[model samples]
Target: MNNYNLNHLKELESEAIYVLREVASQFQNPAILFSGGKDSIILTHLALKAFYPAKIPFPLVHIDTGHNFPETIKFRDDIVDRLGARLIVGSVQNTINDGKVREESGRDASRNALQTVTLLDAIEENKIDCAIGGARRDEEKSRAKERFFSHRDEFGQWNPKHQRAELWNLFNGRMNSGEHFRAFPISNWTEMDVWQYILSEGIDVPSLYIAHNREVVWRNNTWLPYSDLIKLRPEEEIVEKLVRFRTLGDITITGAIESGADSLTKVVVEVASSRQTERGNRSDDKRSETSMEDRKRLGYF
Candidate 1:
């Protein structure tokens, strides 16, 4: 007889893989939300592994806020091409031009909030029944209460309190017409677990994660990337600094921290010793304590 004991991380990976298979086996028009971020990249890799001997069964969707790093866009295109997966992009700029959303006017204004409208529009236009995301519970307080198969109403709104109870790995994917599901395959993984898994699996990530010298401005207590979209107040000044992005988002709001962690091993060590949450670098969440929760209620992913 053979005996096997799975570690916690392996158990999580197995569970995520099972969820990926379930999405493929259940949904009719499923799509994976791929932003080329570490979380999404890991999810894509896991999906590939889950369906070994066959290409991913779903298309890749990117809700483009029009403020992403060039490296992230390049990585997104490259991965989609390599995997032969279809890519769908919903542009926020288009939404603003069409008057579907309004662009904010301020020194720190960002299109991050407007991305929700574009994302929902994309889902409706593409008729995507299920959107698989890489959102993890540890990322935010509200996200911690998310289910593996999170249901969304016809308007794509999330009711956190009314979520179905998941028991014994059974998921109730039943939904009414026009309603959809937001599936999170890696909902239980934490930042440290993600870094450790990336290191262990030798996953390829964007160069922005590694320490590099770039022109940045001090804003909101973190170094903001110097970009045309980034407004500079009279007090703010740009300077060259050694920085790396902990989480990639709109250039106007995403913060980079001073780091020398250039490799996956170094990154894992840094994450293990870090005190701040990964979303700490994201300025959108800084708007309010329940910002993410409110956004989720309003149909934001």
Candidate 2:
């Protein structure tokens, strides 16, 4: 009668909870960046767990790309309302209107790049000293170099080489005026780790994560959802497929994976034995070899 071995997941949970609490205690105005994606959902769940019996002290910030999936937006609103957490939307469209950013023009252009400006503008406008996110080092090579408490300059830009030495779990969140930090709670967790944790905790995510029938087109080595944001080229044709999204954002660029992992158990199994990286289906990252690094350097969620 001695076969309980969920300690690994428990440890990860504890570490994330500790980071969330640290963010709350150290930053004056901190907000969790909620993207309605798998990672961000886990962050929200951890925040709730960290401050149970008391409401989450920080608000949830969503940088709206205007090209989001309808389901993702609905799920975001529902989660915020259910949690009674304040929601702030940094609209890329509004940033465009303010002349703070410009909309890219092309069949392949997406608001993914424009989101950086909107996110940084939001930080400046809201005076958010620290922004918490759910990025993991194992997700991509660029993020692998990120620190638990990453610093940003006054312009919201990050010099990868200038990153402070983070050794022995000693995080230095202190920053000068007009500068801020981006804290990642589950920065050490991997894709399989996330799925396993979600499975163990029964955390609910958007339906798109589960297999479903949707109109999609094959392009750029992945299935692209049919949406108003996309103007299908002549070479592409829509067909119904039982597919699910591995990542989400700027519907125009997000890609879907062909799968039948509808249940959490099935999804965990799929993730456990999958060959592709979770971010493999993301067209945004596939834009160039240094796409993610370039974006993270500029400012991102």
Candidate 3:
């Protein structure tokens, strides 16, 4: 116990930096999945710090559901431009137009589940051998079992039970042709750690996290934002509420929590004291007990 004086945050930062460097050194065509979310922003910032004086080695990949928040899109483009990194968008609209996937019909239907197809399409089209994401173990039970270097089959399907052993950070990145890997540099990080890291690093994120007044409707025990994709019920009346998004996704599925935590410190405090998980706001995951698992098996991230 005497030698445990090292800061845990610093240790996590070191590990993430190591993982970033490993991706650069190992993969031929790698890219970071940037969604303009807080986690992605932190991941991108760490990548820049990992290779200072040298630009990020890989491009940024975003699977646009065509239902993202306007602020998120603006922030995404701004970050890419500032970082001088290439941005590739895999649009769900293109997938629908090409008949690759059909749009869901219903008030609860969302494009969140459909993102996997666009993501896989982007990977194949770009010939990307590795995709670094901001996925964290604490976000969901399925993600808890993920490795820092999670391998995917030729079809981009994940086999949790058959995953390769990662002992003492000795990652085995070997994979056959047509097979790629999803690397989570911040796999061990928790929501609290993410907020703390963002505060420490002064990373910029979308304004949706901060409290703002918006016209919302109470549905499915969560506050659903008013969107063209959402169908209104006669009983569910829209009202102005001070709310903030805990997690960003397809506008129809992502829920907002009533909050007044406008600043980063306040946000961190809120997360630290909250009893519910971050994904609690994601209606897509609420559809089934194994929703995330089922989606991940089909190449969802």
lDDT of 1 at 143: 93
Question: Residue-wise lDDT of candidate 1 within 99-209, one digit each (tens)?
Answer: 998889866678888988999999999999899999999899999999999999998999998989999899878889899999999999998888888888888999999
Clashes in model 1: which pairs?
Answer: none
What global local distance difference test value does model 3 have?
Answer: 0.91
TM-score of each: 0.98, 0.96, 0.97
Candidates ranked, most accurate by TM-score first? 1, 3, 2
Off by over 4 Å in 1: none
Query: Which candidate model has the greater lDDT, 1 or 3?
Result: 3
For residues 24-73, write the lDDT of model 3, one tens digit per residue.
88899999999888889999999998999899989999999989888999
Rank candidates, lDDT, best first.
3, 2, 1
lDDT of 2 by residue, 242-284 (tens): 9988778777888899999988889888888889998898888
CA lDDT, every model vs. true structure: 0.90, 0.90, 0.91
lDDT for residue 188 in candidate 3, whole number 0-100 = 86
Cα RMSD, each candidate: 1.1, 1.8, 1.5
